[model samples]
Target chain A: QQQVKQSPQSLIVQKGGISIINCAYENTAFDYFPWYQQFPGKGPALLIAIRPDVSEKKEGRFTISFNKSAKQFSLHIMDSQPGDSATYFCAAGLTGANNLFFGTGTRLTVIP
Target chain B: EPEVTQTPSHQVTQMGQEVILRCVPISNHLYFYWYRQILGQKVEFLVSFYNNEISEKSEIFDDQFSVERPDGSNFTLKIRSTKLEDSAMYFCASSVRLATNEKLFFGSGTQLSVL
Candidate 1:
């Protein structure tokens, strides 16, 4: 299957807290998994990514935990700030593919 | 860093009207793609272009939808007859090369509203 399902539909976190969002996919051909962050009126921007070969990848305060056997992945934001409030999308794609399959998106709100 | 750019932030059209959404992908990128997202929905792939031709397309891209490279820099998606269901935010994206590790650069998007 090509779908990448993400949850929860929305999340609320306090400053200095850790925020987590999960995603699952049924497509074994997907070799690249990336998470994107989108502000209200802007395009989705790359946040962090991980491959099936690695269990996890971290970039600054953002980390991606990937599970190949379970066909799942997640994004963790440390020290969540109000500025981090936005919609986050998880996407999957294969090498040489024309495009990526996106999740429904999660709206994250970090409160002060 | 270079980024993809799209024109006409928003466009309103009546049913049966023709409309063209335009995009200028990163100058040096070799792969170009068009994706659309209905309000509160997941982003869906429409089509992909490389070497001035369409390399792939999704089922959502039907007969009424077409894509053109017009020139070296501009990539366009033309909807010959728009329906209310066609309303959505269309995004343009590009990548320098094809690989599992490459990241895509996306345009802000063009919101098309069909009435």
Candidate 2:
């Protein structure tokens, strides 16, 4: 069972625009949600993460908005830049299950 | 910032041959995990280890695959009989606590190519 689902296999945005990627999960047991950014030939790096208790979290240009009731969460990139171009993955983790369940990645490309 | 390190960034192995991939997880991190991603595919979990024992594992971790922390500083994944389909990028990650999945530091990964 693919517990987590992601939308928009690919996304294209202009510089200085807002880029958003959404994800939904069925396992309510998940308490932690983390987003990873990966580039070609590179390993996935931790970008930003949030817990169900918090609705939103912002770190510089990256932000995570969580909707606990809907079992959905999203990543928002403000003033998107070309450097932000990469594959983004949303993952959910349960307290008992340390392993993460990753969603199908969304490849984001920002045109300058 | 401590980070995981992997050896032999790329490996080409013959089918049915045994191959071992090594990793050095971040210091002070007690929890370690192994994950793999086939080209153009989503990352999939293989196994997780803690306190010198396997905490969990996925179905993909079968008869051909095994994990060991031979020593305190190194973790290794051995494939007994490599198959063409086994080719993928293997990543090692470590976290501070199982209670919180906050940040997982990952190594660049070892790209395995089965021929």
Candidate 3:
């Protein structure tokens, strides 16, 4: 069973535009939501994360908007750049658990 | 920043042969994890280890798979018999704490190809 589902397998955005990716999770036990950025031939790196306590969290140009009632979260990249083009994955996990359920991933391309 | 290290960035093995993927997690990290990503697929958790034992594992981890921390600094995953479907990119990750919220440092990966 897929615990987390993501949409828009691929995305393209012009530089300086906004890029958005969305994900939904089925497990309510999940309290930690994180977004990971992966480059070709590299492992996924932690980009930004948020707890269910907040409706939104922002780190520079990266923002995570979470809706607990909807069991959904989305990542928004403002002023997207070519360097930001990479595979983005949304993951969910429990507070004390050691495993994370990851989304299928969205490959973003920021064209100049 | 400290990072997890995996050896033999790429490995090719014949089917039914045994293969062991090695990893050296961050020195100060107490939690270790193994995750795999099949081509064009989502990353899946295989197992988690802490205090020298497996804390949790997913259904994909069957009897064919095993994990070990033979030395204080090294963690390894062994597949007794490689299957064609085992071809994937294996990642090793480590964290300072067990909380899922904690940041996990990941190694680039070991691309295993089973023929």
Candidate 4:
């Protein structure tokens, strides 16, 4: 299948807490997975990404845990802060494809 | 850092009129794409361009839509006949390479309202 499904349409997390968002895809052809963060009136910016060859990747407080067998991946934001509130999107793409299959976004809210 | 730039941040057009949304992708990027998101909806892929030609398109890109790289620096999406339902925030993106592993830089977007 071509769809990427993301869960928890909206999430509320307290400051200094951990915020996690999950996504699943049915397309096994997808080898590259990426997460994007979008602020109001701005284009979605690349937050972090992972390849199927690796199980996890971390940059700063952001970590992406990928499950190749389950066709699932998640974004974990450690020490969530008010400034980190935004709409997060998960997307899947094939190795050589030009287009990305995006999931319905998750609106993340961090209350300070 | 280089960024993709779009023109006419907002455009309101009457139904049946033709509208063209313009974008100038990153100077050195070779792959360009157009995507749209209706208000409160997921961002959907419209089309992708490489080597000055379209490489892929989604079902949402109907016969009324066309994409062109008219010059060395600009890529444009044209709607031959606009309808009320065509209103959305259209985004232009570009990547330095063809592989999905490369990150695509996107422009802010052009909000089109077909009235």
Candidate 5:
């Protein structure tokens, strides 16, 4: 129930296009979900996050859509730019949880 | 904006040698954690520390592994005897506190190479 599975091991989109990555979790207890972006030689940084209470959350060009009943979530990057190319990870944790369950990760590439 | 930082960005040690990975979490953060990534694999959780005590740990964290808050400014992961399979990138993370409202901040990570 702690596993999070991410799909589309890799994705490539043209500039100004939409890039999507999907993740699903089996743990209904998870209340906190986050997406992390990582670059070569750098630590994974928090990109955006959402609580199960909301269906979606947007930060600029990044949007996270959550489906509680479906036990799934997705990340959409609008107007995908080359700068957006990197490894993205989806994670989940519950209240009082000591560890965050992570997905396999997706590599997104935006061709300019 | 505060982030966790790790030391000795890269370390190469011989098999069976002792290894210690160090980290300096955000000053005010109350929870600290250790994670590792084997090349081409997903990151794996090792342990979590809170109130200067271990709150939880994964099965991967065996007797050979131990964590210490040693002093106020640092947290450390000690491996009594390393093996070739132990080679990987070690990441240290911290959080405001271990709750639903807080997110973990990660370090750049230290690459451990066991030869």
Candidate 6:
């Protein structure tokens, strides 16, 4: 069974525009939600993360809005740039568990 | 920043052969994990190791798959008999703590192709 589901398999945005990706999870035990960015032929790296305690968290131009009741979270990138174009994945994990459930991933392309 | 290192970025093997993928995680990390991603698919967790033994494993980790920490520094995953469906990118990750909030550093991955 798919624990986490993501929408918009691919996305395209113009430079300086906003890019958004959404994900929903099924398990209520999950308390940590993180977003990872991956370039071609590279491993996924941590971009930003949020705990269920807060409804929203922002780091520079990146923001994560989480809704606990809905079990959904979304990532927003403001003033998107060509360099920000990459595959973004949303993951959820329990407090002490060693495993994480990852989304299918969204490939974003920021065109100049 | 420290990173996980994997050897032999790509490997091609005939079906029914044995293959071992090696990794050297960050020095201070205490937790190790193996994950795999098939072409255009979501990343799936295979197994997790700590204190020289497997703590958790997914259904995908069957009898053919095994993990070992041969020494203090190296972690390895071995497949006794390769199958065509085993073609995927295998990633090694490590973290200093087991908390969900802690970051997990991952290696670039080893692309395995079974013929």
lDDT of 4 by residue, B7-81 (tens): 889999999999999999999889999999888777899999999899999999999999999878999999999
By summed lDDT, the worst window of 10 consecutive residues in model 4 chain A runs over A1-10
**What digit string (tens of lDDT, one per residue) describes model 2 on residues A19-83?**
99999999888999999998886778989999988999999999999999999999999999999
Score candidate 4 by lDDT. 0.92
Please identify which of the two predictions, 5 or 6, would achieve the higher lDDT against the true structure.
6
Tens digits of lDDT, candidate 5, B41-65: 7778899999989999999899989
Q: Which 10-residue span in candidate 2 chain B carries the lowest summed lDDT?
A: B97-106
lDDT of 5 by residue, A55-81 (tens): 999999999999999999999999999
Candidate 6 chain A worst ten-residue window by lDDT? A38-47
* Local lDDT at B8 for model 4: 82
What is the C-alpha local distance difference test score of each model? 0.91, 0.90, 0.94, 0.92, 0.91, 0.94
Alpha-carbon shift of residue A98 in model 3 (angstroms): 1.0
Clashing pairs in 3: none
Q: What is the TM-score of chain B in candidate 5?
A: 0.96
True contacts kept of 1: 0.69
In model 5, which runs have C-alpha deviations exceeding 4 angstroms? none
Candidate with top DockQ is: 3
Question: TM-score of every model?
Answer: 0.97, 0.94, 0.98, 0.96, 0.95, 0.98
Q: How well is candidate 4 docked (DockQ)?
A: 0.76
In model 5 chain B, where is the ten-residue run with the lowest total lDDT? B95-104
Worst 10 residues of 4 chain B by lDDT: B95-104
lDDT of 3 by residue, A1-112 (tens): 9999997899999999999999999999899999999998778899999999999999999999999999999999999999999999999999889899999999999999
| Number of the candidate with higher DockQ, 4 or 5 | 4
True contacts kept of each: 0.69, 0.59, 0.84, 0.79, 0.60, 0.71
Candidate 6 lDDT tens digits, A46-108:
999999999999999999999999999999999999999999999999988989999999999
* Model 2 CA deviation exceeding 4 Å by range: none
Question: Candidate 4 on A43-107: residue-level lDDT in tens?
Answer: 88899999999999999999999998898999999999999999999999998888998888999
